[model samples]
Target: MIRWNVVLAGGIGSRFWPLSTPARPKQLLPLVTDAPMLRDTLDRLRPSAPPERTLVLTNAELRDAILALEPTLPPENVVAEPRPAGTCAALAWAASLIARRDGPEAVMVCTHADWAIGDVPQFRDTLDRAAETAATTHALVTVGIVPSRPDTGFGYIQPGTAIESAPGAAGEVRRVARFVEKPDQARATQMVADGFLWNSGIFAWRVGDLLEEIAALTPEVQPALVAAGTNLERFFADVQSIAIDVGVLERSARVLVLAGQFGWDDVGTWAALHRVRQHDGQDNAMSGPTYALAASGNVVHAEGTQVVLYGVNDLVVVAREGLVMVTTREHAANLKTLLDAMPAEVREP
Candidate 1:
């Protein structure tokens, strides 16, 4: 089966505050390594799906920037959503495009762009296995990450009874018992201890299988998809803002979860920098011109001048383009509320 990968790179990333804005969002920023997260994602998946087949779906405002970032990708392969139509609609459009070009049997690998993946080879290997499983069983396959800890920030997946491997795939595939929303700390801890895997948002499926499933299970976006044809803007205009997990995957009976274990994080908040970036003895991760002295568990990102932190612990400090933000690590995740309270002028720039 032909392999096609869809990299969804659309998000405002408000949690990153002054550093991440609409023009240069988290996926476009070089948060983890020297390159942007989208570039890292492309490099990792190109082995399985080349630039010819890989598609980068982003906001219409960010389309030009994405093209500038990945010049090797075909111009037509870079698609921009006219509006915020959610992943279900985005993937439906992508699958439709792939089906039109390659065929309905093509395997499409879908993932977000702004994520920190520590193991590159392992990540690609897991996707390969997931695609093989999809091709073999015609199942909507998802790579459920082996939970390293009880993370309340992410959704969890419960694996059911052991299932036979797909025809050519030799990976451990299990039926999806159930999909759980983000749980509280205690519930997350209990689920982790009970062998629930973190839903990594990495998926693989055949174009036909997914389209058939969407046509049967999800009427929220399917009717719009049918009416729009090649007009993606029309599709988005009519489709409801329902996530793929809820609109399709959660409702499908032909779903399989393959347990994956490669260091992965969605990097949703400023506090995630501590987990992904390299830290000093005091557990400080800094980017750009920044210095931390006797600062333990602090994340500093400075773009203009040097940022020196002394005698502070567990603080998130960021400086960029004359905007400076300082907040405690515990409070970093709630930057959305803080942004919402601020005026548009202050929040945008």
Candidate 2:
């Protein structure tokens, strides 16, 4: 039994441009299905915990918009980060709050709000198991997806030794040998062959255990514990920016990874629609007033207008009121480069 808190919803998500604006990011868009990606994430967690226990950490600029989108959650539960201090600070802050409200024994399951899990039941089961592993082992646990393909986009986790079988379950808990960032094509293929699991960025830990790990591994946010109530803004401003994976999980000695079988995909780019969304017979993902002809393996999303595509293969086509973007699906992951190359006036709405 764990109380989960989700984060990283304020991003502009330029990879899903046109539909994804500064006012409404990808998490707020119905990228995969009818509901927004954030909404889907919240719905998935409902079986494990209620809205009161689940906190949403996001930027101040998008706070009101997020609240408007998810009016069901308590306004207070929607935490507005004073600044973008990265996951190390954000997770530390959320863990501190959970420890204060609930007891330090409270287990917190942390995840991003913009992912797509194919099987809801398996997702819940894996998360519940991870929570148990965290509570009993007192170790920081991360869910590693059983890779179905050699995905170079996601990080890889190497399992060390099996700790114990998950009480009557088929597979056992395992010690994490090492964490590897996104690798080259050959390395990714070899890793898949070597039984590597995709690092799903799903984490579980006791509030107290995580706080202690932050104190030991991440000195950047350590001071915030004392300044939390007094000067929150100054505390966030002063902390060094780092992700939890780099600051704590990678350095900490007490880390474990559990193999997750549920279909998981981090819909981080336009190209990811192929993995998460329903495709046609020719392998095209069409959404929001879109029609494809002679377009194989393409992703087309129209925000408020009709988009007609023809003779385009492996392309990402998007059309909205103010803008339209057309590019190869292979280049969809690197939209930042396109944004960087564009003029500010044209880029900004």
Candidate 3:
């Protein structure tokens, strides 16, 4: 029933400060491989959803760049958000477009443009399962990654009672017992040990169902949707910025979670490269002609210059555009704070 896909690609990727700027965010960067993350995302989904049926929602400033990345998609398909209304409004608008074109019953698969999925086949399978589950159950569906580690940066979902799949066979389907945001290290570890799943931010739902739930449960974005029909600017101004998880998934009772284990990583910060990128024997993940003599647990991204890490461990080194930044892995995600403290001359181009 999934006839369309809505890809959210508007984030500025503040966590990756030095490399990710307003014009060129992490979504446009080749952090995972040689191609841009957005391009990789489209390519990953093309097998199940064609570019004709896909709609990309991005900021006004980055519309041209996104359209340039995929020429097969019509110019109108690359929609530029009039304002930063967050994911809830974006998804709502996307669902409205799908409903208008494909009818209310058409299922839409929603995902972000900036994610590192290791197993493409398994990843597609999980999404397909989510789409199938949503089609048959007529419920908002989310894919929950089987926790591989105690990641404090991501939200966790506790699964509830099991349910039968579309074929009446018992599947990994379960009602979401609870949703917990980024937690302390102790709590994250305990949750992982207790079989909690990482909130993958992947969703599937019919346009009618999603809109109905939003109208009933999320009042903040519901009014905006009414305005979205006529005036997008007023809609963004009226709605409070809210993520789909908090605005809809957490509050909606008709939500289901499916256990997913396909090597998923958010790649939120520079340090995340160590987890998603391929590493050498020394446990170093490097790109753009780099060598490590004895480095271990270091993530390096070099461009326009060769970088060699000697006997360094747990460090992040980035070289680009004549600017070099070096920081410990633990401090890599804090680059935003560092950028804030830097003078405007040094912070912005």
Each model's TM-score, in the order given? 0.97, 0.95, 0.96
lDDT of 2 by residue, 1-349 (tens): 4466555565678777657777788888888889989888888888788878888888888889888877878887888877788888888888888888887888999888899989999999988889988888889999999999998899999998887644325446788899999999999999999999999989999999999988987887787666656455766878888888899989898898888988889998999998889998778998889887877999888878899888889988888887888999899999889888898887886
Q: Please give the lDDT score at residue 292 for candidate 1.
A: 75
True-structure lDDT of candidate 2: 0.85
Q: How many residue pairs clash (N, CA or C atoms closer than 3 angstroms) in each of the candidate models, in the order given?
A: 0, 0, 0
Please give the CA lDDT of all the candidate structures: 0.90, 0.85, 0.88
Query: Cα deviation in Å at residue 165, candidate 1?
Result: 3.4
Q: Across residues 1-349, which tens digit of lDDT does each residue of candidate 3 receive? A: 7578889899789877778888999999999989999999999999988887999999989998888889898887887887898788889888887888888899999888989998899999888888888888999999899988898999999999888655234858998999999999999999999989999899999989999999999888898788768565667678888888889999999999988888888988999999889889998989997889977999999988888889889999998876888999999878878987899877775
lDDT score, candidate 3: 0.88
Candidate 1 structure quality by residue, lDDT tens digits, 1-349: 7999999999778788888888999999989998998999898888887889999989999989999999989988988888988899889999999999999999999999999998988888889888988998899999899998999999999999767656434448999999999999999999999999999999999999999999999999899989999887898899988899999999999999999898998899889999999988788988889877877999888887888999999999988877889999899999988988999888775
- Which residue runs of candidate 3 sit more than 4 Å off their true CA positions? 165-169
TM-score of 1: 0.97
**Models ranked on TM-score:** 1, 3, 2
Q: How many backbone clashes does candidate 3 have?
A: 0
